[model samples]
Target chain A: MTPAVTGVAVTGVAVALPGAADARALLHPARPGAGPVDPAALIGRKGLRFKDRATQLGLHLAYAALSDAGLLQNGELTVRKDRLGAVVSSNLGNVDTVCRAVETISKESTSALSPMDTPNASSNIIASETAIRYGLRGPNLTVCNGRASGLDAIRWAALMLRTGRADHILVTGVEPDNEVTRRLVDGPMADGGAAVVLSRPAGTRARALLGPVLRTAQPADTAHQLVRQVPGGGLWLSAEDHPVPRSALRNALNSWGELSGALGVVQCAAAAGWFAEGNKSPAYALAGAAGAVLLAPEGTP
Target chain B: MTYPILGTGAVASIGADADAIFDSLCAGRSGLAPLRAFDPSRFNAQQLFEIDDRQTEGIDEPGRATRFLVEAIRQAAEDAGLPEDLAGIPVLVGTGLRELRTLELWWRDGVPLDADGLHFEDALRRHFGAVDTHTFAGACSASLYALALAWDLLELGEAETVVVAGCDVVTESMFGQADRVQFDPPPSVRPFDENRQGTILGEGAAAIVLSRSAPAGRPVRGRLHSVAVNCDAHHQTAPDAAGVEDAVRQAQAQAEVTPADIDLVVLHGTGTPLNDRTEAAVTARVFDSPGPALTGIKSLTGHTSGSAGLLSLIVALRSLERGLVPPIAGLADPLPEAAELRLVAGGPLAAPLRLAQVNSFGFGGVNAVAIVGGAA
Candidate 1:
């Protein structure tokens, strides 16, 4: 189904990977043993003490994305706070804080738990704290919907914008790699943030035009259908392992490491970067074994 | 466009399904009891609304919350006359703490924890053959948030059918946090009561099957007119009256109904002093004096966290169909702020209900309100 609001444009993009300057850097493989940069240096240290790693990365990237979108001036939002929204996706955003709270409760008692750190344990803290930091009074949602979360966040943002809920929405996908996450997963994971400022195309300079996001229960068939929609020499990026054998299909996880919830947004940012660099071919990013979305350069049919 | 409520299922402390729970509510049944999920001696509050073992004998195998979710979904799908394998339908599950209890178990008991099981997608895929699943963790209002998204998907013609569910099992960490936060030990949740202390966490799950059109031979339980969600961005735990007012007004506007059109209001009513005062003020400001009958389900359900909103939605639906609004159990002296509002108490209020509104606010200032009407 076609979305009510068409011409949804990517106004800005931001990336917070180690040794990477912009979203374009995500298209290439990361340097060996590269880790996340210090978030304190990027977003300041005032409210960094009690925040979890994922939230910290989210704040920094949100600020950068808003700035890139020209929505921020002198550290204040240029748009009305109530007209701006935020949608965040993270699989293990507060695992460390939650696990620690559980361990503390099991080992000692509630008295040992710090009241200041209690709010951080809630799963929605990352999205809520972002809204708090940015003064966004609009709708705020958090998606932990497994692999498809990043794309799901984008889809929700698109829906909100098309439905006239918000004029501009900041979609963020972030995940933290810590002792708890390492213990939970068997392989290395991406430990950074990616964000995009999505808006109606009337007043904004479009970096890329977002197409309708397709969600299905059948992954293999949907993947094939999406691949067929792309023209020859077009870009096809996927974070999931599909059976399709197109040589041009780039595995986003192989290049950027295992992003988990950050995969879809990161892939979209990379696609936007590709469009920014004057690539004319259609670009598609697929993930989560359930969804796929198309992106094209501005003015493309 | 309103989406038809094809079917609904609920597993709470009061009853196992929607009809049973609504019946229990009408009969003034209280699910509050001595805390048995964990050691009560470790916490200040000794009561919680835990699901009975008899209700979950064969289903509580994997994780309590996951099992509850699967059972609720199965019930909903079966009631909707859909096959067991929900191939094309998308499942949206919401929770404040998805697997925190299991994580706590793994942390304390050395249980093997598969990272994939942390999210409900794998469990849903394995049990119900649901290939497309989305789990929302937007704190207490998570389920309503899922409902809002599901409504949009149907309204936009993105899908023909969708299942929205919310579940949460109270973890020791959450109970401990509440225990440390509350100054007094409350006997039970007393929403809008003059002596209300704080909220007691509950464990349960609820599901609803929504479709673009009603199925043949199946009763259309209710109509989901509209749902609106917004963030207070005011505080982490505290609620803002203006934010709550905005969400309510937005939902009413989207549903194209005036304040007088609403017959009942299902309050979030966490029973905390601040939440009750704020909610009462917002309700009075939104609706006229002695507005639609106001009732809170958390008094009996004991604040089921993320699932609380869906449970309230189910209550609203049942009230519209049955023409009986359940009273707030254990409510004696209502708050002064609620004087201008009709606080249902002293047994069920029998009235011909049509339009009803359900409110659900959560941590991080997330507020969600849904409007529903009786089947005509």
Candidate 2:
């Protein structure tokens, strides 16, 4: 049975990484339509130590979601040992580190490769590091299904939770664009990690409103627009900001400038941005990568 | 809830299926042969349970690891009897190398090699998109972890039937690890015996179709109870002896079966001194009785890396089916520490067994254990 999503909620979500926020300013220049914004040189230096471009953006978005949800406590993020798992999506990881490792592995095969480079090379480094530092010990998966890996990871993470493999789930979709990564993402790319905190249905009014994502079919007409495409087994969707946020799901090209991978981050970005107040019988709908929608709040089902 | 072991098939030098291999193992025959992939030149010792192209022939070309998967999977699928909802089946294939030959050839020689590591997944996806297929690699524990993933999928109801496969073909680069890694003994692999050397690299493919119900094909041999995989975070190559033992106990406990219930044990014997001794000690600690009739397969098959776990389990099942345990092929001298265990040396021995445990511990401290019992 494709279990119906009874409730759609977010609890505590935090972004704790070394250098994600500040590096983003250098990369997230305003596109033609998003209105004029001073480029990185004009933005004040928020210190280089904290921003890994993508992680930095992840921090703000994730922090805002958690803080907005009123779930923030001591900065110390704690999760159940086995029930806590993290799913993070990324289009481009630490490309600088990847390129460095490639050069070193290829040219410096005889010499000892840098231990420092190993962590960054792993596609799931963000999830691994986050869980290690945050004390979460559950299912952890990272996917790089082109730009849609983030959404795909979240979709799977939710399935994990729905299947009772995990209790509270951490879904983070991030894409940090780097110069070296551009070679890989020559078509399009972006920077940021979008995270969502999910829990079991609490049967509250908030559970009644949001409808279940019945099906998330392959991005209908949107698949044709992407510059770089890979046919991996995961769901790939690009989200474009609608004329109004959440007004309707917009394809990547229309949203924020074709958020190829950014669409995955946008799934939660759009969900987290929802200012849905109290509505006891909240309806929830979880759409999959291939247009399979699962409605929640089984009481009605 | 016991996860049914629907159907299993393995491709190795010994035999492609259980019938031929079981007889071979029973007669104390060995499959370990010199490296056939390339010329065995100045390298120290080159023996492995090499696979014949007979198993993977028309399914794939060029004898690549991923192609090995195709071959083994084809047989396993045929053995699985072909479920109606083939689309919903989950394909979980394990590999330590991740098409290492392909990766190496691509990186070093710039030949496209085998695209199975990253591309064949798409083939499975397109063929079985309604079905979920995933690939996992963690050096040696690849298939064991895949087994665990199969269990999780069954438990999670991701699919009613899941195919867990492990495959690896020796690559020149992988062959170099024995020398590159400092711990292995010189050249030869001698498990549980004094003066034991480290593991000799080997490769093959084994796949088991897992499901919630008894498969219509063959009578099931055993049921997979539980699986546990843990990281040492201690070191890259070395085993946290304590971690290994704990993982074993935890997996058994999670399966809710005591060690006393097990009649046989399949060790991840790499034949390295550290491994043999540590595995024996861990077995002593986990098993209620000493060693539980120790059996090692590497002496006959070398080390198949990711496929080792499934390979060993298949051998164990073969032993169970014949109601006799196979001997450890190359134990020259009895190791002092492993003396208590009844080692089936030189040839196969008769034993009534119902339950068993298997281990697959790999580099980067990845460890996995699976407990299988007579079908419920």
Off by over 4 Å in 1: A1-6, A33-35, A249-251, A255-257, A299-301, B54-62
Interface RMSD of 2: 6.1
- Interface DockQ of candidate 2: 0.11
Q: What value of lDDT does candidate 1 attain over all alpha carbons?
A: 0.83
Give one digit per residue, the lDDT tens place, for model 1 in A1-301. Answer: 3322466778888988876658778667777766666888877898888787899999988988999999987889998988899999898888777778777776777778877777877889989999988888888899887778898888888888877778999999998888777677667766886899999753556677777576666667666666555434267677554644556756454554567788788878888777776777667677756455455554643
Q: Which stretches of model 2 miss by more than 4 angstroms?
A: A1-247, A251-270, A273-301, B18-63, B83-85, B112-119, B125-131, B156-158, B170-178, B183-185, B215-218, B273-277, B333-339
Candidate 2 lDDT by residue in tens digits, A1-301: 3233434344433322222222122122334443222223322344324335554454344444434334333654444455665555554444454445434444535133443344343333455454444444555444444433444555555555665656666666666655544444344344454566666553331211122222222444223211112111121223323111243333232223324444444444333222222112211212223222212222332
Q: What is the per-candidate TM-score for chain B?
A: 0.97, 0.89
Q: What's the CA error at residue B131 for candidate 2, in Å?
A: 4.1
User: For every model shown, what is its TM-score relative to the native structure?
Assistant: 0.95, 0.71
Q: Which ten residues in a row have the lowest lDDT in candidate 1 chain B?
A: B53-62
Per-residue lDDT of candidate 2, residues B1-376 (tens digit): 7877767788766776756666665665666665565434423345555675634332223336766677677777777676433565667776665554544444444554322233245545554453345555446776886686677667865568788888877654445434334333345567898987677777678888888988455677577877776544344456778768866887888789887887888888888877778877777667654547778777766788878888787777666665778787777686876767766788777888877788888765557888877654
